[model samples]
Target: MAVLLHRLGLGAYRHRKLVLGIWLAVLAALVTCAGVFGGKLDDRFTVPGTESQRALDTLGRTLPEASGAGAQIVFTAPEGHHVTEARYTAAIAGAEAAAVKAPQVKAVMGPNVSGAVSADRSTAIVQVQYSVQRAEIRPSSLDVIERAAAAAEKNGLRTSVGGSAYGSNGVHIGPSEIIGVGVALLVLVVTFGSLLAAGMSLLPALLGVAVGLAGLLALTPAVSISSTAVTLALMLGLAVGIDYILFILSRHRRQLARGTDPQESIALATGTAGSAVVFAGSTVIIALAALSVIGIPFLTVMGLGAAGAVLVAVLAAITLLPALAGFAGTRLTPKSGGKQAQRSAAPDGSDGRATLGARWVRTVVAKPLLTVLAATGVLVALALPAADLRLALPDNGSAPVASAERKAYDTVSDEFGPGFNGPLLVLTETHDRPGAQAGAKAARELRDLKGIKAVLPPQPTHDSAQTVIQVMPETGPDSPRTARLVRDIRAAAPGIGEATGATVAVTGATAVNIDVSDRLSDSLLPFTAIVVGLSLILLTMVFRSLVIPLKAAVGFLLSVGASLGTVVALFQWGRLADILGLAHTGPVVSFLPVILIGVLFGLAMDYEVFLVSGMREEWVHTGAARASVTDGARHSVRVVTAAALIMFTVFAGFFPLDDALIKPIAFALAVGVAIDAFAVRLTLVPAVLALAGRHAWWLPAWLDRVLPDLDVEGTRLQKASRVVHREPERVS
Candidate 1:
């Protein structure tokens, strides 16, 4: 496959130009389509049975007649006062009027009187419940709530609205995109000094984003994809797309500098580096596909988006790129081979000689233990911050945004209702026995809750014949108070449901958040296991060594831990809140870890592949472990560093994105790449391999028989039939 792809220079000049043009045209067309459909991508996902579907089912069965999408809106003033009759009445009237005209809203019943207003007149809660008359009450739900706030403002009240839909909107997308891009670009710019090369590095990245978005947008009609999903796509696309391209470009650059004929270099690159690119791309693709097992509609969408991007990126890197490189020739590296570049004096120093990339291998064999400890310490230090990780959703409206508007939210809430900006959702379902009055008691009990301001009169579902109860609490959505309400309700549900012979499932803004946290916990173990296991298998295949695979896997984990710990310490547990642009550590975005693992594992392995592949290749020529380690690192240092920089730059770009989830993931990798590429893979991995020597390739005879051999050393394929024969050319 690689051989065929690398043959672009076989054609004449006109054909080469034509082929390049065709690829550009194809890219342009794909990107144009992607732009048209990219806006709808999102990250807000739902656990398969426990998310939207579950809530919908319970609602459908419970109130066949009472068909309205239930939503919560909290109102606030200040904390220490009594509410006069006039003020309370006016607030209620305004809230009611606002709800009536809001899109998707069926009715507005309350400022239902209660403690929901808080002991002081500082806060009040309003229940705005809606019937699904048009689209599902998702993103648009908050728009209507905002419009209602405008209405209430006209009357004399301040408002802070939070709901599942609204909170998703507020997640910080900036950090992820900005950080990811920033980090990736930083690496790329450093790797390839010319802006053009860096720009080229981004080509696959841009395409991945375009295709991932368009495909995800297309899926919205049939699947429940959340707004948060796009952030995942954006992050993954940048990381993989850029890194994959880096691998090919480095190999191509090497061949060009060696003065190989353009056609020969193209083939050798494709047959060698390009093959690794294919396998790496495939690994990421398969890993992403495994997310389908998560039982999460949102995660599945994210998986599909990432997997699609990887597939496209792999194709572009191997096929389109080789053709372009073949067309560019020496121009791509006119000055690269010069000594000023601090380039490795590969033995064949000038174009075609044997290179001394074998030196680093010899050094490692001399001092194995020192090498291993240094690498281990570096990784361990990085993982330290992970232990302090605080998993909480940031209340920057929803995710993380340093927007003035987002900041203004805190001031408004503090002045009016301390808890007004964050709130929780409560879902109530009842059983239909001859007499199941559990639903009624749940409603009455809801009205009596201390922090709640009003409980709407229980309305029988116009669609499901079940009952719907709406309660407004003093805290708005996204607040700890709201989270407490959700927990309290759950604690209370068992007794209430038993008494009524009914089932009550709490699902609202706060409830969903709690659910997300719970679900994340449930998902993390499996996510870790799968990613670690798969990465180990891939590594084992690459090196044919059990101990080495285990070591790499452990190193990967340490990197993950270090990154998380740093983020948590800065953003949550450690309280470097100012540096992180965090007002305070609220809950970390619920999905960050799962998404982080998905991305970080692949990136860590990238360096792993670079270091190990080179070392393994060296081993083929000379079986000395030390020789292989030193030689491999010496050879791989430039290319891997360049690739890592590009990745880091791309990650950093997302720092300006509005979402917070990206920051940790991107920053972790940004720091992690440095550690993995420079310390672990370059220094530690090689040293360890040196110590292990032949054991790095040791496998039980029986196991070896069962496992297939992986040959990453495609060097022999570099010589074509022409290069192979020194005899006089045969007449055609």
Candidate 2:
């Protein structure tokens, strides 16, 4: 494996111009194709075989108007004025006319006919129904609708639009990618101290992300994915890309400083760090692939898309980075006479006794018990809030306060009720018109329920075979208490429908949200267990250690738990809610657990591999576990911390996005990267390794023989290190 990687690196450098030109051509082709044929992304989540979906399908067939994407054109009258006033009425009419003129709009129902005028007559809602599916309606069409609604302001009326269509148009998914790249560039420059070096590291990452996004856009017709998928693909791609380049670049620079020729240095660097990159990238890919086990088509597409991008990033790191480094030559190293140059002068690492990291490791080894306990305690305390985590889909209540959707949500909640923003649709199949009366009785019964605020009268379908009732609850969509109301209604629905001789199902935005949340919640434990178990097995094979893999898994879980707790506190409990731009306090996003587990666990294992591989090499050569622990920690800390900082900066760049779904994701990943890299990898893992001593590397002979040689750090070059540099007890 090391030989193959070394050859690939050498080849990349030998034909550097060809490699660069090929990548350029690929990028050009991908961008050209994307501009001409790329499809727009949209959110179209649905869970088949669920009661909510059944109800939705029934409604779509019986009443086509309610089938397509929906939007509400909201109008507010002048202060202390009634919506029925001449000017306000004219404004409302004008807004409706504008909506009607939209080619995509199938119908515009409003005022008295739609029962949308507020009781106080100060506000009104005009329902705009589209003929096209939600994903089929482009943002430009929504822009036309927004402009039409804006005309109401000319008549002294304040108009705003809200719903899936408007909210979809509000998302700017690609800007965060640019911000992430900018931050990564800065981090690389500061870490490497050379513009050429930094560009070499960042260039491949940018190209990989661009190509990945272009491919994702082109794949949209065959594989359905949301706009959120775009953000995630770019985020993960940029992060992994930069880290991959950093790993190889750091090693290549170290070799150059050691007096090796540039070609041999690049090849050896690739053989070692490139091997780790391959294993780490595979772990990430496998973790993401686990999402396929959940059986959700859209999520599967999203996970695979991200995994594909990561694959590209890894490949680019091995090929494109080396080629660029070849071009960079001596400029990749720092100038003479500075601290870096002084270190470079000590090529054999024989200039001194110990580094700060080695000293810290020695101290921890002297009292491993205390260090391990203290680190464990800190992790446990930070993770406490995770036990009380609540999960739900972000609703209008969670949108940015400045958004039209959020304003509409606030206005409706203030005037009508929080529940008005997410009403439940009760659909029932009945034999005849007499069953409509029974449906009305069921609606009345719903009104008597504890959380019920209001239940509108039942209306029969055009064929008179089905009846639909809209029931408004007292709580908002994202309320922690809302799911209970859904549970209660489902519990009571059967008896009520049976008595009425009808078959009933609950469906709507609120019901779909509840169902999706429940499904995700149910799957979280098993899915997490699978991911952890798979990672543990992989680690066990790579490191040839029983205790090391177990300890690594525990440390990773600690980091993930603590990060989730931080998100729950910030996004769910509303701690720092105002500062974070969260419109309201509510449950965290339902899929956060699975997503966090996959991403954080993969990264945790990645660091463990990079750090431990160095220690494994030292131990194998010196036959002294304690010294190897100190030496490996000393050598790897700089690169590991730099990589972590780059990842943190890229993730943190997304904080200002203010997309409720993305903000928490960004926060969790950022916090997790910080904790995993600094706390778990730097402190806890080393302490545990120190305590375990030689036991940390113990693997049963039979199992060792059975397991595959992962070659995680390139055994060929690592063995060469011992023979080439024989200085005892060096600074590293």
Candidate that scores best on lDDT: 2
Point out where model 2 deviates above 4 Å.
138-148, 169-180, 333-338, 341-363, 431-438, 717-732
Error of 1 at 236 (Å): 2.3
lDDT of 2: 0.81
Residues 372-479, model 2: lDDT tens digits: 899889888889988888888877777778889888888888877888888888887776555577777788778777887888778776657677888888988877
Model 1 scores worst on lDDT over the 10 consecutive residues at 348-357
Which lDDT tens digits does candidate 1 get at residues 125-214?
A: 565655551136555555666677666655555565543334334224454455556656666666665556666667655765565555
Q: Which regions of candidate 1 are displaced past 4 Å?
A: 1-44, 51-56, 60-95, 110-116, 132-162, 165-199, 204-208, 340-345, 348-367, 381-436, 442-459, 463-465, 468-498, 719-732
- Please give the distance, in angstroms, between residue 352's alpha carbon in candidate 2 and its true position after superposition: 3.8
Residue 481's lDDT in candidate 1: 65
TM-scores for all predictions: 0.82, 0.93
How high a TM-score does candidate 2 get?
0.93
Root-mean-square deviation (CA) per prediction:
5.1, 3.6
Q: After the best TM-score superposition of candidate 1, give how far the Cα of residue 472 lies from its true spot, in angstroms.
A: 8.1
* Whole-model Cα lDDT of every candidate shown, in order: 0.61, 0.81
